[model samples]
Target: MSEITPDLVRHLGVLARIQLSDEEVQSLTGQLDAIVDNIAKVSEVATPEVVATSHPIPLENVFRPDVVQQQLTREQVLRNAPDQADGRFRVTAILGEEQ
Candidate 1:
């Protein structure tokens, strides 16, 4: 088991340019050691055949049938636009070009 020492934590703090008090160093030493131990346990149980994944359950693509139905008319959609051209919504040209 890897043990974290106060000296190591203090060195890390210096390297990170963080200021830590004696009490904070003592607290972090134990917390870091616990985290390392838990990671070690997980590594032990992991195997070559077991693929590493971020989620516990298998993920699948969920899709719905693609069907077309009656949608809003051109006039109905143009009503919400701040500016409208002959039959389409009008907006300022983005690429420094005139339509």
Candidate 2:
């Protein structure tokens, strides 16, 4: 397994635009080394015959029947609006002219 050196960590930090202290770089080097080692082990076990799966359990499409349902009347839909005009909800103007 390859070791993650401080130089590698510093390079990664530079690429990611992350400012890291000397101690932080050293600490992250060790952590990243362990993670790489674990990934190497996982990669070794993956075989050509084994199919890759996104989800562990089998999945089935669950769909509801498309049936038209009753809808609220215009008055019922607009009942809770604080302001309304011309059978629709009224909203305040969004833009103003430059002074």
Candidate 3:
């Protein structure tokens, strides 16, 4: 059995900046112990030849090939703008600077 003592839980709470009550600490200790045991069992079955994967099924990128195509001109893009300056969209200064 993995050692999941109350003192360990208390130390973890302190490091995590959480105020855990005694009851909560006691509950978590058992839950965490079970989780650790499960992980240990899984590790025991894992072999050196077995491939590691993040998902159960094979994955592939389902994206279209990147290709340059005809795009809207700057004039067409800025046509709906409320304000324009120097061939670019203009907005109010927001750096607390007087404009």
Candidate 4:
């Protein structure tokens, strides 16, 4: 088992700039010790022969072939615009009077 002492918890609290009370340090020491022990158990089973995987089941990517299709004309697109100028949509200048 990992030795997560109260002193270690106090040192970590100091490093993080947090003022941990005596009660909090006692509580965290037990919690951190349990977490470290569990991690050690997992490490034991993780060997060179065992491959690390994010998921239990295998997954594959499904892709579709890209195909070109008919598109709308410039006039058809500009017809839905709120304002148009020189065959394109026009909006008020944001930064200055220059367009």
Candidate 5:
């Protein structure tokens, strides 16, 4: 079993942008060590014949039948906009460049 020390915890905290006190570092070291040990045991069981799968169950793509639908007219579409002018939806200037 790998030993997780204060130095390791402090290094991890710095990498993750976290600040930990001496007591917190000690506590986290034990917890992290146990987690690493468990992971190591799991890795040991994995074999060459067993393919790694992200999900436990196999999945298939589900597709719906394609169908044509009526779309809104330009006037109707513009009606929903907060600002409209000259038969079109007028939007505020996005870029700072002058027109």
Candidate 6:
């Protein structure tokens, strides 16, 4: 188990260029100690035989097979366009840029 001390917290604060008060130093020492202890507990349970996983439950992709089929033609698609030019849909120029 790793033990976090007020002196270590103060040193970290100095390295980080942070000005910590005595109260902050004491509080961070306890907080950091708890974090380290919890991490150690987790490490103890994580053995080499145990597989690491991002999720508790198994995950799989539910994908449909890719199949090609007949689709609409360009003229059929352009029939509903409010405005089109040069065999394609056209819109007003934006941001003062020209085509």
Model 4 Cα shift for residue 32 (angstroms)? 0.3
Candidate 3, residues 1-99: lDDT per residue as tens digits? Answer: 788888899899998889999999999999888888899998988889888879998899899999999999999999999999988999987897542
Please, what is the whole-model Cα lDDT of each candidate in the order they appear?
A: 0.92, 0.92, 0.91, 0.94, 0.90, 0.92
**Poorly placed runs, candidate 6 (over 4 Å):** 57-99
Which candidate should be chosen as best, given lDDT against the real structure?
4
Best-fitting candidate, scored by TM-score: 3
Which residue segments of model 1 deviate by more than 4 Å? 58-99
Candidate 2 per-residue lDDT, tens place, 1-99, comes to: 677999999999988889999999989998999999999997888889888887999999999999999989999999999999999999988788342
- Backbone clashes for every candidate come to 0, 0, 0, 0, 0, 0
Residue pairs clashing, model 3? none
Error of 3 at 33 (Å): 0.3
lDDT tens digits, residues 1-99, model 1?
A: 686999999999998889999999999999999999999999998999888899899899999999999999999999889999899888887895443
Shift of residue 56 alpha carbon in model 2, Å: 1.3
Per-residue CA lDDT of model 6 for 1-99, tens digit only, reads: 577899999999998889999999999999999999999999999999999999999999899999999999999999999999998999987887542
| Residue 7 displacement (Å), model 3 | 0.8
Model 2: weakest 10-residue lDDT segment is 90-99
Q: With candidate 3 superimposed using the best TM-score fit, by how many Å does residue 52's alpha carbon deviate from the native?
A: 1.2
User: How well does candidate 4 match the true structure in TM-score terms?
Assistant: 0.55
lDDT of 4: 0.94
Better of 3 and 4 by lDDT: 4
| Stretch of 10 with least lDDT, candidate 5 | 90-99
TM, every model = 0.56, 0.56, 0.60, 0.55, 0.56, 0.54
Instruction: Report how far residue 2 has shifted in candidate 3, in Å.
Output: 0.7
Which candidate, 1 or 3, has the higher TM-score? 3
- Candidate 4, pairs of clashing residues: none
